[model samples]
Target chain A: MVVIARSALGKLRGKYDSLSTTEKRIAQLALNSPSTVSEMTIRELASAAGASTASISRFVKRLGYANYREFTMELAHVVVVDAQEGAKLFKELGEGDSLGVIANKVFHSSMASLEATNDALSENDIARAVLKLINAGTVNFFGLGGSSIAALDGYHKFVRTSLNVAYHPDYDIQLMQAAKLTADDCAVVISHSGKNYETIQIVKELKANHVPIIGITSYSGSPLARAATVTLLSLTDEIKYRSEGMYSLISQIAILDSLFMMTVLRSSSRTQPVLMHVRDVIERTREEP
Target chain B: MVVIARSALGKLRGKYDSLSTTEKRIAQLALNSPSTVSEMTIRELASAAGASTASISRFVKRLGYANYREFTMELAHVVVVDAQEGAKLFKELGEGDSLGVIANKVFHSSMASLEATNDALSENDIARAVLKLINAGTVNFFGLGGSSIAALDGYHKFVRTSLNVAYHPDYDIQLMQAAKLTADDCAVVISHSGKNYETIQIVKELKANHVPIIGITSYSGSPLARAATVTLLSLTDEIKYRSEGMYSLISQIAILDSLFMMTVLRSSSRTQPVLMHVRDVIERTREEP
Candidate 1:
């Protein structure tokens, strides 16, 4: 069996001859103005193409899209891949953007970031990090400000593994914890910019103690990235006027998830009983009035 | 211009005659074993139907799916809506669940929870909650343990609105803050059980002070849910042996997101300038080395 690799636009062009008249018009619009077409709702596209929303839906189906949103995502993927013009598709949260647009943007951005981060990660790094974490005497999670959420999430996920995991919401407590770490410890440090002062301070202390560090940050050149033993980068589209590093949090969470799964799978013999116990406790607590 | 609203099975059955021989086989399999088909990868489906992956892809597209994933999501949606058998689709994370399966389950559950939560929320409640929050001298966020993450998230989001928001990670501080609130203030209380001892204590304080309380929890009959002036239920499927109310967190976040968006949009004239300022600060801070 052979797989045919074609761009979304190429596929549309290849299938254009068999499309219905209304579908042909929609295809022409999509191929000619992909950036504009990618942002349009089905109703908007239908009105633009002088067809009903039903016709628009059929047109996308004819072109191998299940629905309109998937068509737009493929169009955006094509635009990002072929022309390197992702800005038009990943426009920032503008003041006038509608609620539906905001919801779509945030969700799609997260999915895209996760895919990109997954692509950027190497299996070797995951294997190495899992080994280090499983064998460590303790695993300390460090983050401050916005990234603290991810740090806490990492702690929450790892706690089920029955590994000696620690995280403090207080910055000073985190610093003190970092200072006391020995070479037997492993550290997972997260900062979107990779340059938050407090995060760097914690990283410095970890480095001084020779702890193996796994860094999750968006910036490849930042201090935290430079300091870590294994650096996993989270990628996000540069959306202007949006909150700082908001999209990166999704990628960071995905990275932690992958690591957690790897650790649990690799250490199943040791971790499975603990997982069951944790589940039992959770089940009991849930039953409480 | 007439649109035919058909189940996914109906659409497939209606279009079956027009499909190629291989596509017909895939369609028959899909209509007969949707639950099994929904979980199969394209290759698996192809093998099961004695067809190529390309044929399966084309068959789903012919049936109006954007791609295989969307096709499965639609299948899951149909299974959910028709048979009311969501348990098969959202089964508990078993010990042998793969990383991909876990990720897919978690993400899809979050999306499903958001849709369910959206459907459950009353516009009147949202509008009323927004009014009280916007007019309140201070908005206190109360949660404990697992719910604290949602509380912290709510605090993080509200801080950008330049509203007088209060949240303390410490239970005592939170209780003290609750005790000090006046009738003019508002409180957003979150708990999955709705019967957590501390959360109920905080709710009692707010009730005594006549502070308008907006509650987010899974159980509508619990004390916290019964005590609040407006309750927005966060719905999740009952997955036995799963961590207690883990999926509810996503629904809670969605509720908070809706509330945040409504608050920002309704008070835009007063909040726009502050939002812009917040964006500027975030942008500058993001650029720092």
Candidate 2:
């Protein structure tokens, strides 16, 4: 076998460095639009990517494949893999992959996400975030899509303490709620893209209103994080493995979980009453139907 | 404050034994479907639930509310709260209560789901499931939606092991693959509800193929688990929370995490190679791009 492929060997990186100039262009174009490669044949791909069929063929051979078919199959594989939060969520719908494989992928990706998040966090940053929640007059959460679910999750865990909390997917009301906040309160915003316009606008409003914000986002430079007083990042390893957005979601939730635990631990004494009261409510709900 | 009524709560053997028959019925219905109460006023609810207005007032009072208006407001509070999981997504995207109130509501609901998952686990059960995985010839993953994400996640972590791994997401294809399996393989079927039709059908195929199945579901008695060789339960607390499905999902993934750790530690030789190989692949890729 030739030695040119990398991602094909599960390396998940460059396979184009050794290519000639024309081959390099094809490789760049293909990497830039891996999705489109799935629809193109060798000849079409070469032409579209500004390379000759000979260069494309030579590139495939260099990648250590027997021929074009094997190469494109791997290309299809990479095209479907989404690495935003590092979750690989495609394959057989039901009679899916081996359980051992499934279990490993899920756990490692989540662990990677957590590690990424932790790496992105500083003790001072966490201390300050903890302080905000502990001292805040109120905490409001805003998220949408799976983020809403994550926000709700964060809310549930945090409310076990004494902090007053709020969250909504509704933009107008979330904005209004943001308006009601002051420097005395802190806002924890959840948005994977950090570019979600409504959430960015809301974060802007929160900042203008003098509310402290803790942001969780995949991208470092997004508006959501920019407006935040403190930011935590969630890392993913399998983001390029699949799509369906589960990878980043788990990462985002993990960060929220961290914030929640920190807040709960910081104020356990005062939060005991609230926690106890909530437990009572839960017990009551469970007793009957 | 007035008591919101529930139908299922009547069957519950909780603290409500002191209530009269009419009150019990109202309470049961309310517990089962609290949002239904939001549509009916105290008088209408009293008649619909087959109780007199006087008893309805008394019933609401018994549940710890001052009057009907208060009861309804709280009912509305529950109704207007955060998003629920499944097909009914974002239909009535409105701001119901204050963002803080909504936030608390969403948080509590998620905690409830996690609590439920915890309740469903047993040390002996988890140990048994882990043992099966550690010793299995191959472990197959099965799921849909968010569950699919969980399955993919499992694959990512385990691929680092020397184990033979495979995962695909198409249900029809999964059925075919299940047919190719032997009893040596273990299929880990994940469903928030054991009730999803595709999940059930896949389980059936695995059954026919004599492949041992490990089920992950919320309810122990659900068909998917009932038919499995091993079953792991992910529970949710009894809150009429939306995004409930996702809670079960988190629970499922958490259990998968436990299983993955167990497998990794148990299979020392296998674990190192998988991780090292994948890491080497990654390193090579890094050098290229």
Chain A of model 2 scored by TM-score: 0.63
Q: Provide i-RMS per model in Å.
A: 8.5, 20.7
What lDDT does candidate 2 reach at residue B16? Answer: 71
What is the clash tally of candidate 1?
4
Which candidate leads the pack in DockQ?
Answer: 1
Tell me the tens digit of each residue's lDDT in model 1 across A1-289.
Answer: 1222334675564455457788789888897788678767888999999999999888788766767766776665565454532443666665586555555455455545554555445545565677789999999999887788778878887898879999998899999999999989999999988888778888999999999999988876678888999887776644443355655765676677667766776778898889879867654554334
What class would a CAPRI assessor give candidate 2's docking? incorrect
In order, candidate lDDTs are 0.75, 0.63
Residues A3-49, candidate 2, lDDT per residue (tens digit)? 22223422212223235678668766665666577457788998897
Per-residue lDDT, model 1, residue B153, is 77
* DockQ of each candidate relative to the true complex: 0.14, 0.01
Model 1 residue runs over 4 Å out of place are A1-125, A220-223, A232-241, A247-251, A254-258, A261-266, A272-289, B1-94, B97-105, B237-241, B276-289
Question: lDDT tens string, model 1, B160-180?
Answer: 886899999899999899999
lDDT of 2 at A129: 77
